[model samples]
Target chain A: MSLFIVNILDGLVTGLLLFMLCSGLTLIFSMMGVLNFAHASFYMLGAYFGYQISTYVGFWPGLILAPIIVGFIGAAVERYGLRRVHKFGHVPELIFTFGLALLIEEVVQYFWGKSQMAFEAPGVLKFAAFSIAGNAFPAYKVFMIFIAMGVFLVLLYILTKTRIGMIIQAALSYPETVQNLGHNVPMIFMGVFGVGTAMAAIAGVIAGPVLGTFPGMAVLLGSIVFVTIVIGGLGSLWGALVASLLIGWLQTFAAAYNLRMADLLVAIGLTEPVDVAQSMLSDLWTLTLPQVGPILPYLLMIIVLVIRPNGLLGKRET
Target chain B: MNRFTKSLLGAAFAGAAMVGSFSIAHAEGTIKIAFIDPLSGPFASTGNQGLSHYKFAAEELVNSKGGVLDGQKFEIVAFDNKISAKESLIQLKVAIDQGIRFIAQGNSSGVANAITDAVKKHNRRNPDQQVIFLNYSAVDPALTNDKCNFWHFRFDANADIKMDALTDVMAANEDIKKVYLIGQDYSFGKAVAAAAVKFLKAKRPDVEIVGNELHPIGKVKDFTPYARKIIASGADAMITGNWGSDMVGLGKAVIEAGFDNPIYTYYAASDGITKTFGEAGEGKLKLVMEGQLNPPVSDRAAAYTAKFEKQYPDYDIGQPRIANVIEMLAKAINKAGTATDMAKVAYALEGMEHDSIWGTKVVMRASDHQAIQDVHILAHTAKDVTFDFDNSGYGLRAESTVKMASADSATTCKMKRP
Candidate 1:
């Protein structure tokens, strides 16, 4: 069905956007063994910065420059701020990131105030890509999918093909050995942290118009980022990709169809068919794919955590 | 020597006595009013706006003009609610512990329900200490319908009232044979959608119900699939109870799909969506608001906005709902002639007939404490800017069309004023 195809595409695009944030979080979690709660806050910063820069110099350049600025800030935080907190143990590192997340939101409010910023789509990407089953898929959505895929590929290439990539992987599994092997391990950690944050920033630039640049975006995206990383496995990039796509597709399909629970119950012989109007749970049980989209990723994460523990494709790190 | 010592002691005692008397004179007793809302978390934007409006009303405006009540100065005591129902229970206790009697604002219905229960329990235990809860927003119809409280006074129309009014507008346009109903999945959204369906079915029996979709709130980052559903449903028009990102994203997705069908939405449209779609949204979307920024605004509304713009250069004064509530509350206090007695204030508010910036007089129904006001319908228009290379500019112009709905017709509360 055309509806089926459209939902798949919608899911793919949504999944890819989730991947952008999850990928960065997974990389940082693998390398540092500390969950950076502020990762989504960095993404929010990207959106606000992109909005400000685009307002002055147009959206395209802001798209490019905002990530770099965010990258430097991430790197600086890892080097000076996070490094000091890291010595206090993993809990303190998490607490620092949490504090950073709260601070970033407050700072954003102080600057932009508590209101939604109207970030419009650029002229070039305004039109629909094409129509399927009487529905037009916008050019911006295609642009977003390509941008996310590009980021994923670039990250994959850097992690696998390059000498620095091998060094980073070695540092992640056996940091003590890697440091003993005479490589600048701390510098590498900081670089990876910066690179991860930059990816989230890139997502923010592209997503700002669609999501609306607001003070609450960071808090909204924060848990989802954690969910994606957890479901994928904290240190596994491939696991994250798999989980993101799965979640995206699952939610899209959920919101697209309207399947009432009463129908299911009657078919399964659990309950007799009665007037749906009489049931208090009828309205609640009318499960549509769209209604379940946002919570699907968390549900998947909890399921994965209970079952696999180490994630679908993740290797257990000491 | 004894006389000199006595005179020095007497001078010190007189100075101390003068300082004590001055402190007592300045105090005059402070009345603490709690401003309860989501001060932190995702809904903080709405919550913060509510807080700001209350502060401006209490401290900068009302209190500055010799306070709301004679012999008592109104003091606003606010706290970060975190926007949770369970958290509101704790916050209510904290507010009570701080000696706050009159609660001014509650943003969400879920949180308000918890606070109301807490207030009721406190009242039952100590019959003399009953707190008055004034709600500004939270448009769940059940608040006035099944869950009407004697202590709670809702200022805004419930979801049912607004939806009924919306249905009335659509009933006149016989050409609109089919409509797609979309709303955020919450109490407010469900109530609005239910009211729309009920009224539309009863009034327009010939009209077909095409698609009614309830999407998850805050989680819908991409609404392309939903737009596809609307298009496929072949609806004549769309009525949405979406606000914030859901509204913005859904509008953009719908616009991009070339879905030229009219969109009739419940929420205000001064931000996000109009800003996102720009000129593309012109003539396509019809947003209903309480007041308009365009000329023909009442002298009071114009002067208030002008003064507000001068005071806060960054803020958009087009959002007059919160400010209007503040003015109405102030007027209620003035009419009652006593700020300390909430029963008197409530009585004044019930029968209160006042003119607002909308250039129309609103009457507060004494039955349910709901305000009957005019809904300003506007169409988005493209601005002709020669400096722009493309059609990148848009402005919300007030359309010539006006539709009026009486406040009494929508309310289900069968209350007789005491």
Candidate 2:
């Protein structure tokens, strides 16, 4: 069915966008054992910056400039804010980031106010790239998919195949040894942190037009990013990729299918209730898959946490 | 759960502090009115705009016209309820504690229901300390029907009334063969959907109901999947009761996905939705509401529009009902001969007839406290519109008007007068 294909495309777009955020978050967690709670806020910053710059400069220039500006902000945050709190252990770092998240939201509201911004994709991407079953899949989404893939490949190369990547990973476990080798570990940590946040901003710049650039944009994607990386295995990049795609397809298929729990219960030998609205189990009887689509990722995270606490591809035993 | 509850409590404290600051510099003898609505969160823009309207109307209409009760200034105070029913009750207690005698809130029907119930009980418990609720935008018919309260006076036409007008216009359009209904999964959303189903069936029996869907309120990040479903459903037109961010998201997504059919909406033309819809849905969006904006109904309407644009350039008078609320409230207060006489003021408001800011007659029906007024169905288009929304060069062009007689719905209200 063309509907089926469209769902796949839709799912892929959602999954890849999630990956864009997840990859940065996983990278930062692996490089420095810090769970950046304010990662999504950087994405929100990216959107606002993009909107502002595009209003003056244009989308093409904003795309390149927004992330760079956000990277500098992220670097400053790591240098001035996170580094001071780093000595107090992980909980304090998390507390700092959490506070930072709230602060970013308030600052954004102060500046842009609490309404959806009119940040649109450029005119070039407005036309349909293709159509399936009378649905014109726009060019912007395809651009998003490719940009996400490019980010994945480039990040993989930088982390695995390059000299800076080698030093960054080496410093994670043996910071003293890496630092003694005439390299600054603190600066490296800040760089990784900046890069991670910059990647999040990149996601923001692209997805802002589609998902809407609003004050609540960061909060909307906050919990879901945690779910994706958790299900993927905390420090595993490939696991994050697999998990993001899985969630994408799972949610897409779940939304597409109008399967009812009552049908499932009946199929499993339970009798259906008459006068369903008045039945004690009316909620269960009428519950549909699509209604619970948003919760599937969290449910999956719980299952993974219970079945394999370390995650699907995580190397650590804990 | 502990963290969640702590954050909620923290927010409540902060809200109380904000309300505390607003209570100072009251100006003695000023008739204080509490505007309890969300000053923050997802629906903040809508609520904030409502607050601005109340403030402006109180100043420009009531207070500036030499004040009510002969030079007793009208003051509007802000209370952040966060759009939660429980929070709204919390704010109501705070408002009542501050000696505020009137409450204006209309953003959420669920919150409105909670406020009405609390006000009813509060009046019964302390009749001497009664506060009249001036409902401006909450339009659930149940508020005026089964849950009707004597202290509550709704200036906006209820949902059923709007649907009566919407379906009346929709039924006349032959191109609409299949209808898809989508709304937020909440009381207001459900009310709009139910009203649409009832009216559509009654008016256009031949129209096939293709899809009736409900998505969670303010939770959906992407509406592309929903748009894909609508595209697959082959619906000729989609009806949504979503407001605020939901309206913006749904409108943008459907247009992006090339679902070029018409979208019939309740609150799609203001509160930043108009500009977004203008960018995406130029000719595809239609809205039904009270008051006129594009072609100002009269000279006074035109002057008020110009003044509003000057006062709050960022805000449009999204709820013309808010102006009606202030206008009628001031009239009732003046007629009652005392601002503190809640009973007399409520009585005066009953069956009151007044012209709205848009130069239309609004009648506050005695039985239900629901305003019966002319409802206009406006198309969000760039054609033949002088006053554009959000300065987007696309504004509402009135397509059809439903008079009060045809738009009126018979209520099941059994008035329990005090």
Candidate 3:
């Protein structure tokens, strides 16, 4: 019973982190129809910026300030940089983002060098929240969960309640009609792009200490974030949330349990140990969900692309 | 031509001829030592350190006095393998094409494995242009065991050697009966953990193995849960083969969870780990390795360390293995009187005794080319806590005790001298 609770909590924490990156990515993709390959690079930039600022201003202010700076940078980039490249078609736009990722990483290296910079959690969040059956859950994790939940709620409210929300929803269905009704579609895209980057930056601030602040971090998270967006349905916010939660839970449960294929084989009365180490079966038996967590979203993406095409909760053809 | 004008033209021609000769000599000259390692990605820090140390040794120590091989200056041409095996092999081919004879470094085990065959083949093809590989860090036991080669010289002890030494230390402490094993799920990790188990069981049959866990490399964020499992296993000591970020991060997590049991690790804990563990790590961890960090070091070593710190403030000279390797390489080149001749340098290195920055005379065993040195088992003392080495006469409390393994009995590698 305690184990089950532990797994669920683990799933929730992991899920929230995935949602943070995926939510921004999906929103941007919906508005722009261009996958920002450099989305994770923005996250890495946030972490580096947060590390620098927090050194002077402390963690709380850095967390709040870093995202705003990253968002502004995102807006500027979309306005001047990505906007010019977008005219070259989707493939070129994709190439531009890829190049941007490489450039950001180089810039990061130029400033921060190759070593990992230490970014500690705030003093208040350093302690454990409580122990469950002799295992202590960290206070910082609880804080992270609360922060993620707050972001999700605020984003949901802004998207569903405001005039901007209606415009975005309308634009998603018929961009031509929305533009025809006197809305500047390009400005909307730039705004969505800014907000998306800000979300990624916020995720970076929270994750810096755990994932580490390094130049390679962008590359590590870049493909995984793409997988997250694809699995969530390219442009569906709700689908992203659901998919993130599902993946988070799946990985957590897999790691928590010590289930092996040998155990399964025994259960089914195939008691003879059939050269388990001789084949890929050993890799399967040893495969914990967390071990395969980075690939899970990609596998789901392939399945969705083949089966649903529009993605779960994604809008069907008009 | 007139006499005065003819003289001027002759001088100009002579100067031009001399300039041409100098450029040709330089282009044809440099005896290239090819350094291959991952120069990008997460593991790049290790590669950078290796490059810096090699550069330092080559410049300040080797070439400064009078150069090597009858005053022929040494040159190092580096290639970034990026920690990929396939890439390293390609890089090796490129290095070979560039007329590289002397090779060094196996920065990561996988890269080392990939380039080993190339090193062997090149040496066989061009006997006069022999390639000698000096392994700075890759401690995979299989490299010396099943994959042992004549051309390869491991500067550090193989994984099994270190693990065996660790096991010997554990055997004396009978109080450490129940052992929990955790390591990165890879070949090096597996070898170290397996060696630990094998040696411990053979030496002390009463010692029980409580639990064995393998964590995926580069994936684990939180190791607190892993720590909890170790505590639940009721183990007296926890053994691990994790290093670098994995080591530091996991060590911090374990320390935060207040794991009081003695942690026996196969590699040296970095200053990074000590910083993460903060005040908690003091006297709690025991890392068995080839050298010590604080004190009992000679005045010369102390001065060298002070100088090193002044030069490179960002990095720590506390890593004895790195310092020792640099010292040995320098001494070998000086003794051999040539950097290019593999036979002379290899001979000078084999059974060579020299003083290291750690303030100990380490003898390189001729048989296996392993350093026969004292494994200085240093304890983590708080930065604030000062031990009076000379004034108080209290000496250093080794937390547990330092166990020195004699280099004589460890190996019996039969080699034919060239």
Name the best candidate (by TM-score).
2
The 10-residue segment of model 1 chain B with minimum total lDDT is B383-392
**Positional deviation of residue B176's Cα in model 1 after best superposition, in angstroms:** 2.2
Docking class of 3: acceptable
lDDT per residue, candidate 3, A65-125, as tens digits? 9999999999999999999998889999999988999999987876666656667778888
Instruction: For residues B168-264, write the lDDT of model 3, one tens digit per residue.
Output: 7788886888998888888877777788788888888999988766778866655545665665567888888887767766666665554677777
- Badly placed stretches (over 4 Å) of model 2 are B1-25, B69-71, B84-99, B125-129, B405-408
Clashes of 2: 0
Identify the superior model by TM-score, candidate 2 or candidate 3.
Answer: 2
lDDT of 2 at B116: 93
Docking class of 1: acceptable
Interface RMSD of 3: 13.7
Cα-lDDT of candidate 3: 0.71
Every model's TM-score: 0.80, 0.93, 0.84
What TM-score, to 2 decimals, does candidate 1 have? 0.80
DockQ of all predictions against the true structure, Cα-based: 0.40, 0.38, 0.25
Q: For every candidate, what share of the true interface contacts is present? A: 0.56, 0.53, 0.10
For candidate 1, write residues B260-349 as lDDT tens digits. Answer: 877887654543445555676777877665556555366655565555545543334334555556667777777889665666777777
Better of 1 and 2 by TM-score: 2
